[model samples]
Target: MFTGLSAFPLTPVSGNAGIDEKAYGRLVHRLATTSVDSIGALGSTGSYAYLTREERARVARLAVEHADGVPVIVGIGALRTRHVLEAAEDAQNAGAAGVLLAPVSYQPLTDDDVFGLFEEVSAHLSVPLVIYDNPGTTHFTFTDELYTRLAHLPNVASVKIPGVPADPEAARARIEHLRRLLPATVTIGVSGDATAAKGLNAGCDAWYSVIGGTFPEPALALTRAAQAGQPERAERDSQRLQPLWDLFAQHGGSLRVVAAAAAHLGLTTPRNLPLPLRGLGAKEHAQVAAVIEKLQLHA
Candidate 1:
């Protein structure tokens, strides 16, 4: 079962040329060395939507290869169901442990549409399927009923919820309700590092972390505190990351912040982003650097 911090690494791009395989492999090595629960490539942070199917497959292959003994989960979401299925097949062939999927659509998708999409994709996959409920990106929210339905599907292993509510009480209550609704087999994973402490305290089984994917040590530290039921320690660790999270909020979020942070830490080359989306400016880079310095993060 997928549990603990599942790091989602960014896919390094060499301008418009294509994926920077060398840098991407370095990221996988870093995460594997940190011993994160798992590594997810081609996630939203990886900019899966911007890459071609072939590029994504290459990423999955490289991630699986460089991950050493670590399990790899590749994101296979696309607007078209056939494209998603093809990506799933590619991930499975690449020896990935599972595939993460979100119901990405140009038009608003109904519950039936989302359900049918997963049904079709799951029918074709032999590996585990993780339902990525990132409404912020997909613009398609899954109700409790729909999540429950998806949980019962064959090969459906877990679901990644966006995060808990900001309100502490509401967040706990929401997680409790979800626990009641979802089967024991379907692990409830939380995303969005901002509210991660609250989400984990509320009983989330795993953390699908963005920042952890970029720099797993601190995030892994926070996850250990949370898992140990040390709320005060977890909150302190989360607060320590607030400055960096603040930069993410001010800028374009994890996609941009992670790229900037990775560059600042010398993990990859600067300006390694796809077209239509550029790297952070000098001022923004300064902000991320300041936060990293303040946090005392050593790569």
Candidate 2:
């Protein structure tokens, strides 16, 4: 359903309670004006697990309404198959181009259990389904065998791999392994924001990105260079983003960093995430500002 950079905006909740609808409109508008191939609503960066179903549905509607023709992909992952089906229905009704599905789990899942989840969802989905293989969050890893099987399922369009091994040689080899097994039409998306540029160079078709969702221009620069085989330029720009990436690594990853950076840039209101997951403090906020300003990305 997509290729190139698919930017996942942090779901901005207004200070009072629910999603900041106006702020979300502005966020989607900002990304739609860029070279991004798609805008993903409720991806991990969007805090999908924290929001209520009503909020998730509302976010999907607002994202599609303001995306200005850029395809809006909603993260519709839920622990139960029935819940996922309901969210998929919401996404389709809201006019999202596709729905991102992950195998959310409390109890461990067997391969048949995981495959059956997609099978059930796909049977009811009219829109394309992006298989989110984020073991870090979902705790369910897709073996190559499983991915091969899922890739053959109806409505399955892409697979978002959350990690590409850090070693360049191993990373490329892993990409090749997936390429060898997956259906030719299925796009391989790389999602580790810290190493996205390298992943792009390693042959991932799309960057299912975190940092790029907040600061797309620089991310696109890196993606373009790598896609065009200009590794040196890609590396240079990726290096420029190292400071910001460091903050993500240090401060509970992209969910916190993007929310903090978005507020710092005045792109969204100052808001805390759902409880037990606090926003960045003053010290970390200062670090974000310094890095954004240093890279001249506050533009």
Candidate 3:
């Protein structure tokens, strides 16, 4: 479940309405039909932080149901350890193959605090747990020492690190260093879609992707190429999507651009993000459409 492309699908919610289960199921089913190794139901890209517990549980169940036989890894992050435990229980009940936990908090969390959270959660989880080190959203940076500590916890299967360095050798060195620190039982997955190919080439075990949630084909193509030791093909496939990566940088991050792309493809309703968040405007949508067309992403 931790290896290859773990596609994190958006949890589409219309304005002043509940989750669009039909649309969400469509996204999960689409991924299951593809070569994605796992379905990441409610990661950062899925807007798990914004939904209620009931809503999140429903989304987890939906993801598992729609995923066919593909493994489903559900995000179970919350502000409090109690709530995180509750979310973990809900995900387990929903038959999630694994749970992804990010240390989310309003107040800054110390390494001990973060480790305690994982320790408590890991003790309770029957399935594997992926340590989500998404500092971009959680605002808690994890050190190699912290990773070593957390990796020692039982049921902790993988660590989703941030992007690797742009330079190839530097990226490989970074990954190699982490590999030595982490137990062989624990895998190191890479986030940051733009650098996924490089990370894989650097020997990272998986791509915890944002764009893969919406466009599995290209992401899977890159993943398969990399895993097959065809680094040149993987890099070329990644370079081909540079325009979309630029769009992610132009916008705040991947969440908005991917939502816009999904809407453009008619895979989900326009403005499908949760309340207090809005989709791209007309001009930006036009740009997304152009990029999708040019890349032949929908073909």
Candidate 4:
């Protein structure tokens, strides 16, 4: 399958900050109409860490239901391997196409911990497995060696490597070498977007994206262009998305930024960030609104 934009949407929050199926379905519908190859719910973009088990499963079902045909990759990240295994089973029961796992949590883990974690989870699961790399928070990266190890695991289907823009060309070369470690059936992934096209062109099989959560059309268009070797066109669209990038850059790894984008397009209901991490304040929201308007996105 062609690796294209995979919009990892935020789970909607209702009036009391509960899971909002209505809002989530609406957002999913909008994305489903785009060229997104897949949809991910309860992933980092969906604030999976903040949700209860029931809420995560509910969002997983909602995402698949609304996607209609687009595969739903549910986020099954947790602090323990057993919990992740259980969540993966839950996602499978909930009809998710696959499971996306972020390595460990809270405390930093050694490379051996990562190997054992993936090995354990992959052993228990029947579905395709995806590795989520969010070094901005994990503070621990999947080293070339670590990834090499996980890539050999049976159920490992893909790797989601994000924020390597510092030297994307070099990252691509590195990923290409790493791809050698994985099975041929396994495809590599990047957190797709305009700026991400470089790595995609270099060798990504897919893009698991937060930006695609709101701008699937534009983002997918760019990814398609890049895949076709149309670097000039892809660069143009990536440049067009700079403002949105600026917003997330300011947040510095806050997954809440996905919700902010949803609000920007008026696709989500009145949503608030759960405890600990606050959403953009009043003035910030207004400024974000101004930028979204200038870009002429939905809403």
Candidate 5:
């Protein structure tokens, strides 16, 4: 579940209608039919922070039900430790193979505060846990010392680090440094879709991808090529999808752009994001459509 391409799908929510179960299920089922290694439900890409506990739990069940034997990793992050534990329990009861936890808080967290949360939660979890270190959303940067402490916890299976350096040597060194600090059992997975191939080629064990959820084939191609030790092939595959990555940069972030792509593909309705968050406009959607058509990402 921790290794390879773990695709995070959006939790398609229609305004006031709550979760669009059919569309969310469609997204998970689509990935299950492909070669993705695992399904990541309710991660940052899935808008886990925006949904209620009940909605998140239902989404977890739906993902597991439609995954077709692929392992499901459910995100269980919240502002409070108690709430995080509740979410974790719900995910485990729903048959998630593992749970992903990010240290989210309204106020800035000290290293001890973050460590204590993991210590308490890790002690109670039955399934494996992935340490989600997404500083962009959480605003909490993780030092190597913190990672070492968390990696030693009983169910700490992997650490999902942020993007690596763009230069090949720098990326390799960054991954290598983390490898030395973390225990041998814990794998290092990389986020930042654009740098996924570079991370993998540099020795990261997996990719926690956003685009892989919506378009599995291309992500799988790049992942497989990297895992097979064909770095050049992986790099070439990533280069081909530069347009889509560019759209992610231009359209704020991946959530809006991917929601737009999903809508454009008819996998979900337009404006599928939760309230206060809008999908791409007509001009942006047209641009995304053109890129999809040109890339032949019809899958």
Candidate 6:
């Protein structure tokens, strides 16, 4: 199972309306130089849903190619089973370590339908799968029982559960149940720095981090703390991430925070957003820039 921080780099774009492969490689090169355990592109932060099928394939291919030895996992969130299989195939073809699977987006699907989609994915794809359970995007949350059933599927190697809760402790327990119930070969994961430390304490094997995509040094420090059983230091790092959380929640939607962080790091512009969604307005950019300035952390 993969552990520690994983970067979700912004998918770079050229001014002439094409993916800037050079910039994309530079981002991946930067991540490889960091201490992050892996780099996962094409997730929510990478604007996976906005990209066309070919564009998504290019992002996955480029991320893996530039990541060198670091495990590269590309998010595969498609409404159709055929599209899902195609994404998975593309990821394996690009040499990605695995695929991050999310259920059909926007439209609400039954829990059984979600599991069925993943089961179909498991049957055809040779690469290990990491379940992506981010309710903020799908508007559907999977329970421990449901997550376990999915994780136990053959070829399922890991799970990424975003820790979003009024009470971190309760969220931690449900995620832990997936880890405990699944076969030893399966890994349970969590993201959201606010609850990452708790997830690690609760027995999650990894942090499927977005912030790590921009600020790998600090994120890796937090993971190292957890690995060393240093709860005090981990807590300190978690507290430090509060500003990043505020940057997103203050405005709402998944892209703002990462985009803000990337802007702060001088890695990309705050105006850059993938398809289906546009860039942030000037006022919102000001707010994000102000908050990110306090963090004084850059790419």
- lDDT of model 3 at position 176: 98
Candidate 6 Cα outliers beyond 4 Å, as residue runs = 14-16, 164-172
Count clashing residue pairs per candidate.
Answer: 0, 0, 0, 0, 0, 1
All models, RMSD in angstroms: 1.0, 1.3, 0.7, 2.0, 0.8, 2.1
Clashing pairs in 2: none
Give the lDDT of residue 161 in candidate 3. 98
Better by TM-score, candidate 6 or 4: 4
TM-score for each model: 0.98, 0.96, 0.99, 0.92, 0.98, 0.92
Candidate 5 Cα outliers beyond 4 Å, as residue runs: none
What does the lDDT read for residue 168 in candidate 3?
Answer: 97
Task: Give the per-residue lDDT of model 1 (tens digit) for 1-299.
Answer: 38899999888896888888899999999999999999988899999999998998999999999999899999999999989999999999999999999999999999999999999888898899999999878989899999999988989999899878988789999999998988888898999889998889888989999988888998899999999989889889998888887887888577888898888888878977898888788998888888888889867
| Greater-lDDT candidate between 1 and 3 | 3
Instruction: Give model 6 RMSD, 1 decimal.
Output: 2.1
Ranking of models by TM-score: 3, 5, 1, 2, 4, 6
- lDDT (10s digit) by residue, model 4, range 108-177: 7999988888889889887888888877656778777787788889878888877445466786776778
Candidate numbers sorted by lDDT from highest down = 3, 5, 1, 2, 6, 4
Runs in model 2 deviating more than 4 A are none
Instruction: Name the TM-score of candidate 2.
Output: 0.96
Q: Taking the tens digit of each residue's C-alpha lDDT, what string does model 6 give over 1-299?
A: 37777778777653237676777788888999885788988988787777788998998888878887888988888889889888888888888888898886667888899989988999988778888888877888887778778877888888787874536577666765564678888777787666787787666788887777777787788888988988778878888878777766776754666665566567764446654455566787777777667877755
Best by TM-score: 3
Off by over 4 Å in 4: 14-16, 165-172, 192-194
Estimate the overall C-alpha local distance difference test score of candidate 5. 0.94
TM-score of 3: 0.99
Top-lDDT structure, candidate number? 3
